[model samples]
Target: MSLLFSEEEFQSAWTELDEPQLDGGWELFTESMGVKIYRLYDQDTGLYEYKVFGVLDSCPPELCADVYMDLDYRKQWDGYVKELHQDQFEGRPAVYWQVKYPFPLSNRDYVYVRERRDLDLDGRRIWVILAHSSPETPCAERSGVLRVRQYRQSVAMETDGARGAKVFMRYFDNPGGMIPAWLVNWAAKSGVPNFLTDMQKACSNYAAYCQRK
Candidate 1:
């Protein structure tokens, strides 16, 4: 049902459990908050693609997936989100997100299409979400914001019986403009674990949020 990926690609997402490396060059990057991060350098772009594996010990798999896809709730919890909305582009669902950067840095934005799938693999449940930057520019360019042209992301969450869920996430996006390597590296080291921590809190508050809605 994804306009961006074929059925084979959808099914192949589950294979991340066994083979996390789709490309052959991932190296151990860091580990924090019980999460292990791996980085793969792209010689073509001089950017690093990151793959992360971790367990959300308290949040349920479905809750984690829902929290991730809930754009409205995201605005309430994610402080970096300046503007976000969903749209239809070329008959496919697309999302436009404007993110606020630290002072002295210009804000960055993205226009991408995303899809989510819930699969029952021999009675085991899996949630997969894939997002890619649209090939063609779908929306008008903003005046002061830099638009990121290359981005790719995928997440696979597998339930672990009564424990919780095991999560695998891979993503890369070139934040347009000249960004310091140290800044990017620091974000990778600290940003992911911080996001996961916030997400877990958001998951715990989701039921209450929905009730208020």
Candidate 2:
């Protein structure tokens, strides 16, 4: 079976998340919602990458994966997401996301190719989901909406003992505009924790909903 992302790319991302280099440009920023967040400067692009990690108690790895993969449930929890839809790009699964921005800033949207993989790492099961912006997708930029030209995000989840899931995420996006660097940094520091909290709650809710069905 063919894969959307090459094996090398997947393995590289997984390794990076599993054993991140804390000394090289990555700085611990804040801890909130039981998650530790880090910020790193991308010297090449002059942008910052946000790295987040935490463990959710009583949530299995599979449940965490299910919450992330389910797009319909995303709209229920992700407040910034204004629109989301599944699409295909070059015969690969892709998604279009229109996100709402704060006032005076235009909304941003992205078309990204998403892929999921389950792997065995040192006798432990890990699930990884990756998404990267794809300009090749034939999606027109909407009026009053800025197209995110550069964006990549990934999440890795693995079981912690018998009843917990450890989650790690790395995200970076260049919202092309004259927005001040300070504002972007502020959002990254303040917004990511809230996002993760909401995501954790959503996972819990989804698990309960599934149990009922």
Candidate 3:
């Protein structure tokens, strides 16, 4: 299948993987699970931006990337994801993800086309997986769920010898409805570190699972 994003879009996204500079408004939110999390104000979206970086010890870069691409097994580790499936839009690949939310809040969903590539940056091998919401893909709205209209997330993994891999992520999503900004920021701060920790364990478990299969 062909890529949903154009060459320019891919290049711009790849360039930003070098850890984009945060303006004066950005703040060092928190550090946990060996990952440093940062937050910044997004003038265009009127929402707080988030970036996470860390290294997963003993997990190879390719193995880490495989865990993400293996969509059918996501539920085995990703506690936030309720449902996930794949489809095609005009012959391009697309994914639908339904996320779980706490009580009194409606669940959120996203439909996006994900693309991955491997490149050498300064003699270091890196694997990048990028996903952005595509509302143009025909999908039926789910009851009691809010569709995320704007979302973009990416993962960058660089090899750290045979020991492990260095991982970086940049994510932004506008959960539709009357949620408070403070709550949103708080969730990003508290949930991300735990999420990364889960991911590290997931990678290791998945690698073992694959070998046994």
Candidate 4:
């Protein structure tokens, strides 16, 4: 028992969330039942400003499951990013998960892998798996697994005669998840100044990246 509506209709339905604004930002506002919703707003270098949104079940295990599994998820289309601050994603691909079953229901499952083209490296990617089992039994949940696993990666980026490496690991397990407070606070922030240092190193070491050809 579900229904669909045009963007205007949907927007009209929730008059409260609406606000008069310019074209560079968007917001979410709602006080509803049975479902949750969010919105996005944007403006291109030379395009009209507009917005879009989504609605899902309250608990969202199903949504989370799908986002965490879909192996070829990145191929069909780069998933949409829900949070801009997390990924700093302006137009980056948003990888999502997909689930097969619920938690504490299955146990004979092996972990799986997915490639991370998102980083431009051909072999980097995050893996997916069940994080835990039901307390009552060692069985899996009917909701299956609500987790994703990503492999660690390291890259050597060079620019302006400097060489350095970028560690493609989560600030934690899955940087795609929540970043540690220090990342934004100061430690990671310091990396910005070192950009030229890496570039200079790479430029000075050009022969290292080449094979005498």
Candidate 5:
């Protein structure tokens, strides 16, 4: 199948994150270390779509964007990534990822297409990355893992002076099983912050990593 979405979809995502309002069923989920996470519940799926806006202090937009797109380097830093690799199906590039989950819960995997864009809007440079699962994928589900059939994520970043960036992200995925609401809520409240913290450390070490490679 073709890539799940197009450029217009990514543009729309950037616009939505550019100016997020609290009144649009988006409630504040958490705020810490200059980042704020928000969530909007979907009545139809009984799931939550999360949005995050924040300043990545002392991290340049270019570096942040590059780090996000550097799949080969991602495994060196991101522990949650059990398996990640790129593939070509029908002449289109697709990414296959297996993510680790907490004990007692099965691991989850995804097959998606991703794109990166650089835009200049209103004289401001913005970097965007978009990803969504394909409808009819060639990847088969693993025996002990669940496939996240419905998954999507978008991120936008812009310079916030010489050494910082204003970052925004939207994330959602159906884990595809009987998962408890409380567990999901707890994961968000804690996981997001931890992820950001790790990313910052990774960014700081990126230059040396590149030098070694």
Candidate 6:
């Protein structure tokens, strides 16, 4: 939750966030767009990633949660989130990053990095396995992508992330990629929207709440 990216990474993301011009907020600016990019972590739900204006005005909490979960390509993007047990959980050094476009790609689902858990920011103890999703379709309104990022930490230097020396997976996805943005942007947009990123945030929050209860 604290600033995860380096100053350079933060500045680069800032440019990307501004290129789209979506009323990037100060809270969003400070968090290095990861806040919006990682909105689900804070809100415990999804919002239209491409919302031009504050279009989603408001909705019932249950309705928003329900809508958010279904729009993602990942199965039960929300339900998959249960709880993290403090006792059984261990830290991992690798981090995984996943991104999904509006449409499905042929021979998709192959974008996963090899031994991805090994990727981290400057040997940082945090291992973030982030996932994203987009329905296999042309881009349209409310057709924003969904993303989920899990921060994993290694429990100990001796554990080898718990799988001994064997390779372990850090990322997963439903399947597919999107058509060129020019095509999607050229066509009319449609549909209710959800974001995997927001869903994971919601899951994280719910899990924390459950842990407290």
- Candidates' TM-scores? 0.93, 0.89, 0.87, 0.19, 0.92, 0.24
Q: Any runs in candidate 6 off by more than 4 Å, and if so which? A: 1-6, 14-107, 110-192, 196-205, 208-213
Give the winner by lDDT.
1
**Per-prediction tally of clashes:** 0, 0, 0, 41, 0, 17
Q: What would the per-residue lDDT of candidate 2 be over residues 38-62, giving only the tens digit for each residue?
A: 8898876667998877787767888
Query: Tens digits of per-residue lDDT for model 6 on 1-213?
Result: 222334443333223322433344412211211222211112222111231111122232232333333323233343323221111112322222233333343221211111112223455322222222322212222223332222221110111233221111111222213444334322312211233234335544554444554
Best by TM-score: 1
Worst 10-residue lDDT window, candidate 3? 1-10
CA RMSD per model (angstroms):
1.7, 2.3, 2.6, 19.8, 2.2, 16.1
Q: Report residue 87 deviation for candidate 1 (angstroms).
A: 1.9
Kindly list the per-residue Cα lDDT of model 1 for residues 30-142, writing each as its tens digit. Answer: 89878899988877667788988888888889999999999999999999999998988666578999999988898999998888899998888899988888758468788
lDDT of candidate 2 vs native? 0.82
lDDT of 4 at 18: 32
Instruction: Give me the runs in candidate 2 sitting further than 4 Å from their true place.
Output: 1-3, 16-18, 89-92, 208-213
Encode model 4's per-residue lDDT on 1-213: one tens digit a residue. 112223343223223223333234444322232212222321221211112222222212222223333333322232222211111123332323342322433222222222212212244321212222112222222343334343222111111112222111111122122434334234323332233233333334343334332
Tens digit per residue, CA lDDT, model 3, 63-173: 888888888778778888899989876765679999999998999999888888877768767788888898988887899999998998887787766688887788888
Q: State, as a TM-score between 0 and 1, how close model 2 is to the true structure.
A: 0.89
The predicted structure with the larger TM-score, 4 or 6, is 6
* Residue lDDT tens for model 5, 1-213: 225557777677677656674576988888999899999997766778889899999788888989888888899999999999999877767899999998889999999988888888888788888888875767777899988898899988888776888888888877878897667767878888898888888889999999999
7: Cα error in model 5, Å: 3.9
Give the Cα lDDT of each candidate. Answer: 0.85, 0.82, 0.79, 0.26, 0.85, 0.26
Which 10-residue window of candidate 1 scores lowest in summed lDDT?
14-23
Candidate 4 stretches with Cα past 4 Å from truth are 1-179, 211-213
